[model samples]
Target: MSLSELFISKELTIKDSLAKLDKTAKRILLVMEDEKLQGIITDGDIRRWILNNGDLNERVELAMNRSPISVYEKDVKKAKEILNTNMIEAIPVLNENNNVVDIIFWNENFNRKLNYYKKLENPVVIMAGGKGTRLEPYTKILPKPLIPIGDTPIVERIINKFNEYGCNNYYMTVNYKKNMIKAYFDEKEKPYQVNFVEEKTPLGTAGSLYLLKGIIKETFFVSNCDILIEGNYSGMLKYHKANNNKITLISSLKHYTIPYGVIEIDKNSIVKGMMEKPEYDYLVNTGMYILEPECLHDIPANTFYHMTELIQHYIDKGEKVGVYPVRENSWLDMGQFKEMENMIERLGVSNE
Candidate 1:
């Protein structure tokens, strides 16, 4: 069955069922009764709820849309037709009794042969020109991106993440001793299409994208050079497409545990609740984004423009900006010395 066809019992509340939904995304079957198809809930559905201000404790039935769209057992042809007609990537298969039987992905089944040669036509813009000032003494010589992560450079790892989704054409924004970066890649003969957009002065993060105004036409991927992402870019793109987002930011869940006991205090030294060593999970940006071509106009030329400022500006103007959360371990930030050491000690062997 398609991941969207499986459903839980009607008795479960939305709050109680959230964990199951996330687990199902990991490929578990969501079943409640004997092969009876109930409406399936997905991560997208929960996010939609949050966006709509639906209460977390509310029953899932209230949130779930009844009469879900489905296809018949012998109707594979119809399913493909429906997918193409609706521009849907996946369709659910149902049996004679209306139970979900399987899922058919159009790209996987019908377009597989064609897709082998036709890569996703999207450019990747990387902000690799920064000097690693935060990385201290290391910044004295090597650029942050060139720092060795086992055999490959940190920037190459970031490029490979986009390449996994068939994005090959790359535009690197270079400044802060640009020759070193050029020399390194020149000596190595990098695998993909690599072009440099030279910055006369240090232009901040999003500033470089302004240089790509004419070169990049469609939705493109932009990422920091010092990050390693384990999440799939193809899936992120799918989410971005489904939402009609102008910009999609990749976020990772980060957990922090309090070292000491924490207390909850009410108005006048009154304790509402008390807990010791509470652990909290937060969604943090992974420094990766998918930007629409139109947004490129907002970036000022030769001026400092950080991604955060751009996002805020868009939000104030009432534009749609979405976030896709990856698991905590999926993000590795090598921008700091400690994280770099941790990356080498823990992930270096694997990267090699």
Candidate 2:
């Protein structure tokens, strides 16, 4: 399809622009008025705006790249050069009047070759021992980690995502319905190596890590089996190593809108100001973490302890605990019914 078909009016709402972006599969849209290029809006722009709690119904211009890189149609060669030199995905071609005439996208092969990540040897520990009380009926027959999303189990999907980045060694902490999880892996002949850490009793999230004191000798990843992070794992690892962080939490941007008007009161119990439904944004823990092997020592053995408690312990000790934030949609939670339905729809899977 012609790139012009992806052009959208700056006045269009962010919601409309998103639809156009998804439909075009171009990851960006040219915001134009009267054939003159106003700005450019990309998926990244929208994600950033959403992270900051920007209203979706607001104009696309609010989140667009007002000074986007562009070149004249005569300078198409220069556009390609810019795309290559800057490692950008696309560039817009404009006319003498600063009007968008065309767009040049980076070659798919170039993108694939340039973006490859090296394989990692660090062991990934998945917390799969939860009772999965939220997904009761399904959990009654199958463990939460074994719950299927599409054709594969949710835990398998999580493992596959990490495997893409060369994380092959896996250590899963299993308690509730532990045998089923181990049996499934035993039956399947796969290239990856998996070791199951069976908990004698219910040990909360971080508690099971105590079992890996001498087992994990390097930096590793820990994740909740029921959740999946679609962001770049290598980037998070890089950040953890670069910052010398003891623990790094992968957080997802979440936006919540208040339905009713909010009132602010003063010390005298008098109203200071009243505003209509205000939206708030937060960085919520996505149950994924990169941690140094040394941190495992902090987990007490044979006791129930949550990951949050471990984080708090580090915080109290003034240790380096960082959070890397990703777009809200990148973190999918399939443990809950609402999020499960959303995941099904997003994956284009039939409910049946």
Candidate 3:
């Protein structure tokens, strides 16, 4: 009934995975072609894929968790330690190449504490209608949402992160290559509910949100498809509600240091103070927001409207507006050329 007993090769059959599942560990190692990871097939993946008529004789590769949550080999022990600290039940182990090698089930380490964080009921509205002018030629063929980050599409990664917080309902605004985005999800048949609103003409950020005015009556989340904002999104919602604000702007504090000494002068006279490579922090809008439903009424129909303009409009009306700061690295903007390259390189965007 231990995790070590559930070990099995990717070459094994679903029958093997099922038999291994009985050994008390809900996870099984999937050793695939060489050291490369195929996936970790979970009992849930098997039960669901099978209920949908998955073959039993098929290799575990078919039911394996292709994008299984993993921690790098170097961090394996640390990952185990953190799991123990957080009281996580099961954690996947991965090699240097991010291949699934083992599973860490700390259920036996039992400290008797259940970490259950309640999630807010907010539907995620992704602004995927843009032509991605920043991404240029790549966007010509594929929309920003379809751009690959690591193994999954950028939008899928966003959805998965939100799903972790129990936010399943998603609304994506689409214009360019709308069919391609739809087709990609259609082929995958993911579990969450996804509704696409086609924009006949390009609507600047907040403008497209007007489409959901009636569809979504409660306060909801709005995020750009090209950027991945990582943090406790639920916490942001809590902040918004706590302040009783009409809108909450997710902001990032970016710190930059000057390479050379800088001087402060008075009236263009002698330098008063000087410092070398002093770091300065500035709050930058992260293109993500939580807005009350009534705010959507301000979005002009079929007109271009940026989120900034909406924020300004509300500010002018004396409506409460708040900014929640997130760490700079947490806001990943893959739309910019430099950001896209860095993300692709760091996350290994190529198919494995």
In terms of TM-score, the best-performing candidate is 2
Q: Which of candidates 2 and 3 reaches a greater TM-score?
A: 2
lDDT of 2: 0.84
lDDT tens per residue, model 2, 327-350: 666778987999998887877776
User: Candidate 2 at 21: error in angstroms?
Assistant: 7.7
lDDT per residue (tens digit) for residues 231-296 in model 3: 667657776888899999888756577999998899979789999887654668888899999987
lDDT of 1: 0.74
Query: Is 1 or 2 the stronger prediction by lDDT?
Result: 2
Q: Flag clash pairs in model 1.
A: none
Q: Score each candidate by Cα lDDT.
A: 0.74, 0.84, 0.75
Kindly report which residue pairs in candidate 3 clash with one another.
10-31
Give the winner by lDDT. Answer: 2
Can you tell me which runs of candidate 2 are displaced by over 4 Å?
Answer: 1-117
Cα deviation at 36, candidate 1, in Å, is: 13
Q: Which residue runs does candidate 3 get wrong by more than 4 Å?
A: 1-119, 268-274, 345-352
